[model samples]
Target: MDFIARATAIVGGTMVLLRRMSAPAAQAVGLTPTIPEAKKQGIMTLKMPTAKGWEPGHKPTAAQGLKVNAFASGLAHPRWIEVLPNGDVLVAEALQTERPPTSLMDRVMQATMKRAKAIGVSANRISLWRDPDGDGVAEVRKVFLEGQNQPFGMALVGDTFYVGNTDGIVAFPYEKGATKLTGPGRKLVDFKPGGHWTRSLIVSPDGTKIYAGVGSLSNIGDSGMEAEEGRAAIWELDLATEKARIFASGLRNAVGTAWEPVTGQLWTVVNERDGLGDETPPDYLTSVQDGGFYGWPYCYWGKTVDDRVEQDAELVARAITPDYALGGHTASLGLCWMPEGTLPGFGDGMVIGQHGSWNRSTLSGYKLIFVPFVDGRPSGAPRDILWGFLSEDEKVSYGRPVGVTIGPDGKSLLMADDVGDVIWRVTGA
Candidate 1:
């Protein structure tokens, strides 16, 4: 190994030893997670499992009352999913765009991501999957759109279909039951792409607007707050006017978004800032308020300041506490509202597809989980819906779950497994 690689190895070894010496803190999960003191490190904990895909006939283990099957396979880094009115499923297949490492930390992160199958060339396309027979598996697959820049989110509003590319939102004309879109799309808005580039799109209940989740450009304004402008928050786009504005700010990386059926409020799952021990600031699920700030580099979990960033007393005072904590470094990326009876024994709740963690000694998430909600607020503890994506020893990952949605049938669940390159469907046993 080169000098830098050798140095990284030595540092990694020391971190592992230190982690073992200090026992892991109690898990921070649920509506009231015990936020621990911040323990900053020059080099954050880096323990990523090698990505070893599943063998033939292998699949994730579903919950006791549910059965799992590969709805579609052979995808190229499928990361997000959208279901059409005609019961066809649309999947966005893309990965992070490559940029040369500019620093030692960048090099280390790039190498680690490669080992975890998180780095790759973007497929830059969206494909359609149709299950006409209502059988668990999809028999028809077609490339619906292509030649796009790192697309992640798709929304069909009226006759216009919208795509959330890494750099902007693009819209194309569409027809009901149509299999492919051939027209060149028009750009609706621009976004600074690169760091934390996945833009998740969701349409409003009235179909008059769209919400896009844009993540931060750096871990904690390390590149200066100016570089993070128009990012790390959700943008509301007026469909009629084709203009967008920041809806909520101060979220480090809010990736998934959904609307609460009862309250008519917007909710999101946010990936918190890193380098603060293994369980200091937990990834969260919260009801997003219009014009509300949730504290990104300035503070966390309400007014608790992160001392690392230059103090912003005014902003910290206004930071809204999240509604629920989903565990630290869990990388929760996909969120969808699951109405009662959609899945067996799963009531009105949100299904989150945790992409899993790479910055902790022990892995946190690599499966699908459900957080029950009563009267539009999260209630009970989270329950595992599907697991076994990681090996028993936790050194190898067979898959990483990403975007999740209710399947076309309205009774099943569909999850995108990017590492496994398969769209899994979950149904009642």
Candidate 2:
């Protein structure tokens, strides 16, 4: 509230003063500011905590190292990932797009998180990685798709690898050792296009249905879908028939969604509606149920209202809100849960790629986090899995992490960075 009130006041005051003050009068006011040269701040420097997987969680003083690998390079704004059975990796690359602009959501995120940014992140198409002959590092680079508006999140159901593009879903056949899309790619489904265009994909447990997450192109409820013109919602499609319909709605930006293996619960990571000034509503992780309506463009986290959203008395009762709240504006993305018997120390852990923030005073989220789950349920709060993408000197960072997927090896973790144009592979120490 303090931040919002302050910013709002500044906004109004600035506009009024700009209208009244002439350029000459303002110049005579002695506002001769110029970009200045730098000076070292002495021993005073930003101290970034070491990452969890890259370093120890707790110690007498600081943290310790686990192990890390910058597995491959030469990627161009790589986004989401899908690990092939044979250990190859498919990453989406973002070539020409810039990050999205910060909206009201960034204001709240900046207020809530320690180091939130005031803008949106961007990404692009898929890049392929293969380590044939059992090499530890990736040895192959290939394009899975070209000329995508922007692509992210992908899943493999049997032989087909499905990719989420800005306005549609496409799939190509996969052979264990194949390095490229085997056949001409086929369009699986399409959605109404708007600004929030990074569609994410996942297959149902049975593989008969394809579950796709479509974000609201805009934070408001009025963003009309392109050809399909509609509000925000998750939709399900019959794979064979190419038929689709709404699965859930009122979710502002459900960027990352996954299905829990043990309980068949559908878990989603959300970038909730922003702009109430920091603590009003948080981005969330939840087991989104069918037909559920987590309020968007009006209410958040079960009725904490934002001025941007029109008030409705029944909004709280009608919406199926988030289960657990992450701090506001972390810019949460790419969600995957470790199934039982995989990643031993994790038992069952949820992985989210926090793209980081620029809308706040301080920055937050430049790495991956682990949410512990028990018997198909979240047991406690999120834990940092891998950290330290931003350097200690970076009070603000240029790198933003976008998506994460478990490495196909079953013992490693994979992450995508839109800013860095590379994939980071973390293995247990």
- Cα lDDT, model 2, residue 131: 74
Tell me the TM-score of each prediction against the true structure: 0.98, 0.76
> Which candidate tops lDDT?
1
Global lDDT of each model? 0.91, 0.62
**Per-residue CA lDDT of candidate 1, range 1-429, in tens?**
145544665687679668756635676899888877888867788887878988999999999999999999999999999999999999999998668888878888777777678887889999999988888899999999999999998999999999999999999999999899977799999999989999999999999999999999998999999999999999999999998999999999999999998999999999998888788789999999999999998999998888889988889989999999999899999999999999888899999999998887677889899999998899999999999999988878999999999998899999999999999999999
Give the TM-score (vs. native) of candidate 1. Answer: 0.98
Summarize candidate 2's per-residue lDDT along 40-134 as a digit string, tens digits.
Answer: 22211122221222232311110133455666666766667888666778887753233343776444333323222222244345677877755
Q: Clashes per prediction? A: 0, 25
Candidate 1: segments with Cα more than 4 A from true spot: 1-10
- Candidate 2's TM-score reads 0.76
Worst 10 residues of 2 by lDDT: 26-35
